[model samples]
Target: MSSDTQQGRFEGKIALVTGAGSGMGAAVARQMAAEGARVVVLADVNGEAAAAVAKELSVGRAVPLDVADGAAVDAAVEDVVREHGRLDVLVHAAGVDDPEAKQLIADALVEGRPPEVTDRLGDSAWRRVMRINLDGTFHVLRAAVRVMRPVRAGAIVVIGSSCVFDTPVGYPHYAASKAGVHALSQAVAKEVIASGIRVNVVAPGPTETGMAARTPDVLRGGFADPRVRPYATPEEIADIALFLASDSAANLVGAVLLANGGRFTA
Candidate 1:
């Protein structure tokens, strides 16, 4: 958990993690709870999954939410604030990234085959991806800022994609959505900085999550090429997210921290 055994960085704090059912989100929630957060809300679209994760953490509470709905997002935030009294840390991790579909596209490209029109960044796929990744980020960010700005102190860590930098082929929709997220984060960071609220992003490359597990072996090998390196564990991504949310990054605002192994360089 970030290798900072010093603990208490988040003691007495309240953290809300969207997509806390699994992957990097769950890892962040666990790490924060270990660091002494008084409360951690596990917000996810999958209520059962969220409940399962919450059952493992003493301070965890599962809240089912769909970030695409503005009203639902607002209500969810209100519930957290009412129960916890304050939201010191927020990790936005809920977004759509269908590994199976992504892997198919990658495999086709590698084999010099033309992807099916319907499956290759079609209008339907584009809209679905954008609604979840782009629109969802907007909904949650707006809801959080409304509550946090008044308090004059809060931290928001957005989970973006390394696709913004790598810009790989076959997944135009995914890359576009994540790039939009980075832009949104930067703009919001500037708008909220004066209010004592910090907003930053974490752009992670392929990691050992359900999303990446569906990739073909050949494609995975390319990702692990000597220069690019192999996939990272969810824990590694969680560590970076924690660091950005912690006071250690007080001087940083609107920064996109990369946790993509060696996929992108300085």
Candidate 2:
């Protein structure tokens, strides 16, 4: 489906993608296969969904996993290693969004808010958001690097949101966590360069995916801007993912590449 596949850069390489059931995760899984990866590990909480995507590609296997569960993540990594012999690539693409819950938290951020109105920053909803996006990311990376380090080679590409910069007023927790991701990725890249592992992040802006389709109607109308007519397709974002996964970006490490479509001026 891509020139990458025809070129066969990933002909014998194996890749593991988290949240491969839907959204950017599914897109990336497909793209990785297209690039000729002999084996791919599709990991997601939704086992059936992951299997379906992996089945569509037909060059990979799926494993139901929750990145939030460290033990589960560890076991899944082991499974991939057992089956593939080594892990060369890891992509973190699963995440969740709840604008309403986030808006409530943002409201509390307003000064003079009643003490009774606790902030969502530390609430259950916020905790879950951070747990999945932040803690889960860390958990997956820890496990991936463990396998990658010994091999003295690997590439980690994480899916981040462009919202981290031009973020809406609501999701402070999500933004903060993603911000932490970029910083941590840079720090980890520096720490692991000597180990022969590379870490980088891709920030996709307003991608056309299941996640965008499910965004509330109120949110959809905001896309009517004439200057920003079309949303970037998941495949376009996957192009960046593939480049990051390949030797094209071999010199890249601790880099945060933004793929947002002029949503915010640099």
Candidate 3:
């Protein structure tokens, strides 16, 4: 670990990070580039954001992608592998919470209202969250596995949410999607272990991202607790992700490495 960390950890590796336009996804892509990845595919639904990030990286290519689009995901994966020969690492961070649903949940938290208030989530909100979070993850995983399987070597890191553990009442869809992610990652890990492909999840608590800022102050204030201190920066989450993607975590397949700031006891 020291040898690589001191000398470009991912040197020569070809890495792809979904949701690389902003937040945790963008941070992971930048970290990989700095660590020496030969090329970092910065994929995001927002083309402008992705391009901005790619422009800043020494080794990066921006690709507009909506993870929910299976064909797009497959095409992107195919292009990356074709151009680079192999994809050594994949980071899936593209996801979303229905704005209405998210705000309703946060309001419930701020007002100290009963959790049942979130039961009003409409069909569209539920579907939107599910499509982006769960189905999107499936699309990326399917595409990545198709290529990495034959090569018999690759690493995958799925961005999950700590909210899945305790189950918050207001955002059932968000919780459900993340829970599905954890299950999917574990199941895929077991199925692909023989192929030497590793799959893992990194569940972060409240992060210092634009999304977190929009949430209720009551929720973001958790960062003020002495025990939790400061909110986690995107880079902090990326560090854990890079560790799981690196050989240092060789034996840590099918694991959920929670990076929450101790907000929940379980």
Candidate 4:
């Protein structure tokens, strides 16, 4: 959507973007369409939202999918290939965070009290996060690999969190889930590179998205620094994802590119 976007970079490529209903996923889908992707399948749990976003693309369609359901994930990827002939790119952006838990921690931080979010975390909450974030990523990535391995040509950019590098307080489950995604991506990247498939991770920090908007101001304030903006835009993050999924990053395999402004240096 910018002048610097490489026109036709994805010409003849078919892309599948999870969490495409909103946030960074939608942004990636939009950019892929702009860059001439043959077809961009917008898959999300929120079917209506995904459909709304798909209406904006020339060759985009909505596919209702809950990535937590491994069987459904496999079916969705198989359907995409069956419909489009080949799967050239995949951007796994579907993930979850406990905003209520984060707010509780932020309250404690503001009140000068020790944050004990994990102690209060229930088994259901923890499992829900892991199911959607870690397990969901595994399912989607595995599905993509199945389709791409035979073709010996494809790119995958999984959306991880900067928390993998610097774990944030009150986000134990979220951080752990993203860490799993990061590790899984590297392991699979090594296994698939020989097959001509490149798998990479984008670890983004505080970005302007629905999730970030839900975060308390007290917590967001911690990210404020004169050196860089407090938050990156979804479109900005999408640019990084799109680059990784394109030939521009052909040599980058198992690389975790951080897009957290200047929050973390490692």
Q: How many residue pairs clash in each candidate?
A: 0, 0, 0, 0
Worst 10-residue stretch by lDDT in candidate 3?
1-10
lDDT of 3: 0.88
After superposing candidate 4 on the true structure, give the runs of residues whose Cα lies further than 4 Å from its correct spot: none
Q: Taking the tens digit of each residue's C-alpha lDDT, what string does model 1 give over 1-266?
A: 66664488889888999989889888988898888889999999998989999999899999998888889999999998998797889999998875646667676777789654344555777788899899999999999999999989999999998889987766677888999999999999999999999999999988887667766776676686787657887888888888899999999999998888776663
- What TM-score does model 2 achieve against the real structure? 0.90
RMSD of each: 1.9, 3.7, 2.3, 0.9
List the pairs of residues colliding in candidate 3. Answer: none
lDDT of 4 by residue, 104-199 (tens): 989999999988898899999999999999999999989999999998999999999999888877789988999999999999999999999999
The collision pairs in model 2 are none
lDDT of 3 by residue, 1-266 (tens): 12234347788999999999999999899889888999999999998999999999989999999999999999999999999999999999999865566566567777788655445777887888889999999999999999999999999999998988977667788899999999999999999989999999999987877677677766566457787647888888888999999988999999998888887755
Please state the error at residue 162 of candidate 1 in Å: 0.8
CA lDDT of each candidate? 0.87, 0.81, 0.88, 0.93
Candidate with more favorable, higher lDDT: 1 or 4? 4
The C-alpha stretches of model 2 lying farther than 4 A from their native spots are: 1-6, 102-122
Ranking according to lDDT, highest score first? 4, 3, 1, 2
